[model samples]
Target chain A: MTPQAQVVEVRAGRTRRRGRLVAAAMAAPAVLVVCAVYAYPALSTLAYSVSKIDLSPRFRIEGFVWLRNFINQLTDAHFWQATWITVYFGVMLCLLTVVLSFLIALLLNKTFFGRGLLRVTVLLPWAVPPVASGVLWVQMFHAEFGFLNGLIRAFGGEGGIIWLGGSTIALHSVLVTEVWRWIPFATLFILAGLQIVPKSVREAAAIDGAGPWRGFRHVTFPLMLPVVVPVVIFLFVWAMKVFDTIFVLTRGGPTRGTTTLNFLTYRQGFVQFDFGNAAATAYLLSALTVVAIAGLGWMLSRSRRLAGM
Target chain B: MVGTSLARRLKRVLMYAAAVLVLIVTAFPLYGIILTSIQTEPDIRSRDVAFVPTYIETEHYQRIFDEASGIPVAESMVNSLVVALATAFLTVAIAVPAAYALHRMSVPGRRVILGGFAAIYVLPTLLFVLPLFIAVVQLGLYDTYIGLVLPYTAFTLPFMVWIMGSFVRAIPVEVEEMARIDGAGLRQLMFRIIIPLLRPGIFAGLLLGFILAWVEFLTPLLFTSDLSILTVTLGLFRSTMDIAIGQLAAATVITALPVILITAIFQRNISEVVTAGVER
Candidate 1:
């Protein structure tokens, strides 16, 4: 090749390399901030899980014990209790949210009067801050002067069930508040999914003389499942990590009936000042989240395959 | 035919009735809170509560502003506004370039970065907050606005990048190539050409990030104990016991007002963002 052509080729290679360098430079700030603020701390917490850390006089990381923290947490009865409670809460919340959202979506999918107004009203609950929702429900569940009891009395019934006072009842009360906050979000998702269903398919189902239930079961639901499955997983993960509403409403109280893994981590780190144990709990919760998400994904794919068959 | 028409009419009526029932269930708490905020203190405390306020009083709101109420309502609101706005600005500013690099430029490990961000998004906040709480103290940033903004920005960056990157990817590569051929530098191409196209995604990201940071309770609760650093959500928890029910209701309404207004104004954009994030 001529010297001029060789020089041009070398220059092109340099420019390409320069472009990649520029791209990396542009991306560096976000990467650095995430690393410094999120990734570093997360890794250090994992480190804390294996070592003894205390922050009384000053922050100090003692020698690593190497799995003792995990062993301790694994053996603790309270850990098992919190795990069971978390799984139950997550599952129940996910089921209720998805089912209720699907129902609401069906209601919303129809062309009806005042549909726009109803849509806005449904979203209002979700717009309220979770902490405020917790406080609002706490007052509503007040035994002496709450609106719930007042309505019950106005209807000529004996009132004043201790909604947030009993152990088992308090967890359900928290569940109610969570379900209230989440339903609107899930509804919007499912409603969006429903809007994408083709008109011809429904018409064909009708022409086939299938009733509404059968049409929905055979055509509409299968189409919506792919959309709904991800939402279900999202809600399940969200419910498992819930801390704000329960913290405000019950504070994981009434004999720890409502304490999930997330709350347990908070209780250990902040209240008990056992940073080691807290980190261990946090790690375990992360592991569980990974496992749950993976398992859910596998199950969803398997179900889709089975349905296809 | 007549029987079918009647059945259709009946079904319509039932649908409307069910819709109204759902609306009432959805809106009752908001209505109750507003009513409580305007009701007399005696009405709130009494067993026989007034379903409708006989006299709509502003005493609760007045008490919230009163110096004797022992709550710094204005200061906390300002703190919340500062932290939220700062977080939104920082997140978008950092995310826009990163998104451009990931989507428009030939960046290595793009998939890995995206996957890592999605994973980070799902992990419990406590996982990071525990070590962050200790680190913030050691770094002497505890109880500072910077401390709050730092974590808020970090937590919000991944989602912002994801959203903005989707928008960036939608811009035709030919447009960017033409701009570059015309001697536009990378910065000029991004700022002069790409940003105008990315307006909706940027607005959605800012609003989402701001709302998330504004509503956040745990981070502030853990990181900052100073009264002045408390946001509105954290402030509500502080005076939950000390304040009367009426004043607490007022506080709740005040805390929720900005969010309500934003949602009302940007309802379509917000919903679009949410649906887009999920659909992808």
Candidate 2:
């Protein structure tokens, strides 16, 4: 209402505008880099999925063929097989890792002698690169001289079995290596969840004549699940797109047994030089990832609401 | 009371036993890799599997460093170092200001920017790498350090921004207000007050970014075919047939050492970063 107040209000507005301008300037570089590196490539891949492109001899983009690559992928038996294998591998790996890590987290939650050292030891597998771990496991499972066979032989049992040789077993062997690398990571998350459980809640359950198992089932497990579910979903999505470990361990394998959708895409693109088909497969894989991520986000929000209640 | 105490002791024993079992399972492969790297090639090939090496040798280690051995161990290591360091530095440099702005400033569409970043994080690397491979070639950047560094930076930026934003938001606004009242400019306020408080997040981002880039396999594999530009991870995969088992083990050790050390030193930061990212 007064002239003095009007002047102060205008000054405040100008200062706010200056602040907004500075923020925009600060954020421009990251936005530019993301556009150049991530958004551009992602959009190009979507475009390539529908059009034929050849990188060999010379780079050329032919006319668009709508849904042809997708149709070919859908009709191809190898694509379906790869899809089945990818789903199977992801489901099996997620279940095993979650169970094993939950048990490990339970054990680690209790105070014991040498607990600190044990924690570090448990995480050792995660520190190794997935590709290097694959190489190590391949040696460990070597038919003749591997430590596994040697142990079997020392126990007075037959020592030779082709661990990575069989079509069925190669995929399973790759699963084992991945489980080894991922369990510790999962355990760390679960353990952190465990620590956040209010001790008083479990104590109250105990005072009400509940036993350890009952208390954990009714109180601890529910509290921990909200934290653990997102982790499981994230790991499942990661396992679905697994490439490096399988590529190193089996090269998608003795008879394409371990060729999941991700590997199949790589094989089509790089090995077969069919960029269109590869992009199509990759886009299909992305669609699956998006579904999984959406499911995770929904679960997370629902759990947060329940926790708030 | 006595019965309950006895039960407690029994449970403690069982827990420790389980802990030891987990430790053995996790550590065995690491031990095997180290033992294999130090053993003579003949011993590695011998029918009798020695849990402890009967004859230890350093020849494999020497072979990796020797140019005459025809292994690109040294070159690959240098390449990995350059690319990883560049990626870490560039990611932090770009992410810090953006995270600060997003947190402190009245930026419109903050949620959309964050959601887009998270969505990019979830997308498979294969999805981007295919198109990126073609782009790099067309731009004449293939087989160069920039080829690998660009993708690595892009891949790491999303999570780095999230982590750094959390750090920025935790800083009390009153400190910035006081500095502003004292006539400090925007740069002065950030460098003198905000940046010092952000040390932990910045260090964590650097280490996390470095590890991700260091262990990356696919990007380097697709972007570069030159052996000289290959990272140790790609080299390890490439040299499986060409090198002896001992030398292969040596190379694996070389590739894994930095990651292991960084992880060990920054265990708290890493655990915090991962749990924060997921739990949020």
Candidate 3:
């Protein structure tokens, strides 16, 4: 190689090195912030889960009792109940929101008068804060003067129903508020998916003497699964962690009916001031969440690949 | 032909019917909240539910703003504004450079960094807020604007970075190359060329950050005890117990207004982002 060619090659190498350095410099701030926020807290929580935290003598950490906190919480009946409630709430929320939103998305996909206005209104619930939505729904569910009862009375049914009073019913009422808030997200996402399902595919199904229902079942729905599955997972994860609506609506309830694992963790930490138990519960909840996501994600990907998607 | 036409007509009618039903279900609660706020306390408590106010009342609104009532609605709004705005600006400032670097440059571990951001974004806040609360206290940042601002930034950063990454990638690399060829420095290329093109993403990120911080309940509830620094959610939480229905409804409406307006104005951009985000 000529000396001048070697010089040009060396200059190119230095420039590339400078570019990498600049990139690192640019990414430094975000990397630092993420570490301070996520890493520190995560490590401390792990430590706290292993150690007993006592507040009586001014917030001191007592001797390490490894695995004791976890064992105690696992054995506790209330912890199991909270776990059951979280799973139940998340599954129901996932099912109802995905189904309802898919139907709405289909409707919205069709060209119709006032479609634009409907689209904007669909986003309203998403914008409303969960705490505020709780406030709104709590008023709506009021036994005597609530609009729901008034509507029931006007329609010749008995007016007074304690919509949020019963232990069984309050969780369902909180479920409704969450569904209301989540539908916007699911609906919008599914609608976008619907648009991507080619017109030719539908027409081909029709040409094969398939009815609308048959076409949807075979062609449209299967194509939509890729979008729907991810949305379902995202909604489920969010539903599992819902706190604000519960905080405002029921405070985990009339009984422990709505005391989800997330709420239970809050109660143990803040209300009961048992940081050790709370931290342990939090870790368990996080582990459950990570496992659920990974498991569902893996299963879905396998199914998709098998189906040749 | 007639049979097919009639069926088509029926289909159209059903579609519109479903659309209207969707609209009512989505919009009714919001309307109810606004109506409840404007209705008199007596009317709200009365058994007769009037969808429209027989008597329009603004007293609930006035009382919320009146500091003499001791609710601190006004004070907390200011606090929320400060925290949310700080979070928005800080998030954008940090996220933009990082996104540009990650997308535009030959960054090592780019995929890992992207995946890490996505993972952190998906993790429940419950997992972090406990330890975060303790750390905030330990660092002596508790009960201050910075305390909430810092955490809010961290929460919003991952999202902003992803969104802004797409925005950065949308700009052709040749644009920056040409600018460099013209002897423009990296700073000049970014500020003069890329930043101008990134306006829409910046706006979306800022709006989203502001909304997230404004609506946040958990962090502020745990971090601060000072009434002056209490956020809107915490203020509303306190008032929910003793406050009148009309007054509480007013507060809810007040809390929701800015978010509603932002969502309405940026519906298209946000919809694109949402679909892009999930479809990723």
After the best TM-score superposition of candidate 3, give how far the Cα of residue A47 lies from its true spot, in angstroms: 0.8
TM-score for each prediction?
Answer: 0.97, 0.96, 0.97
**Candidate 3 ranges beyond 4 A from true positions:** A303-309
Candidate 2: where are CA atoms >4 Å away? B1-6
Ranking of all predicted structures according to lDDT, beginning with the best and ending with the worst: 3, 1, 2
Error of 1 at B170 (Å): 2.8
Candidate 3 chain B, run of 10 with poorest lDDT: B121-130
Q: What share of the true interface contacts does candidate 2 keep?
A: 0.70
lDDT of 1 by residue, A1-309 (tens): 899999999999999999989988888898888888778989889999999987779879888999999999999999999999899899989998888889888999889989998888888888898899988998888888888988888888787788889878999889888988999889989888777667788879989998999998998888777778888888988987899898888899889999999999999999999989999999999999889999889877875675462
TM-score of chain A of each: 0.94, 0.95, 0.96
Higher-DockQ candidate among 1 and 2? 1
- What residue runs in model 1 are displaced by over 4 Å at the alpha carbon? A1-8, A300-309
* Per-candidate interface DockQ score: 0.75, 0.71, 0.74
What's every prediction's RMSD, in angstroms? Answer: 1.8, 1.7, 1.6
TM-score of chain A of 2: 0.95
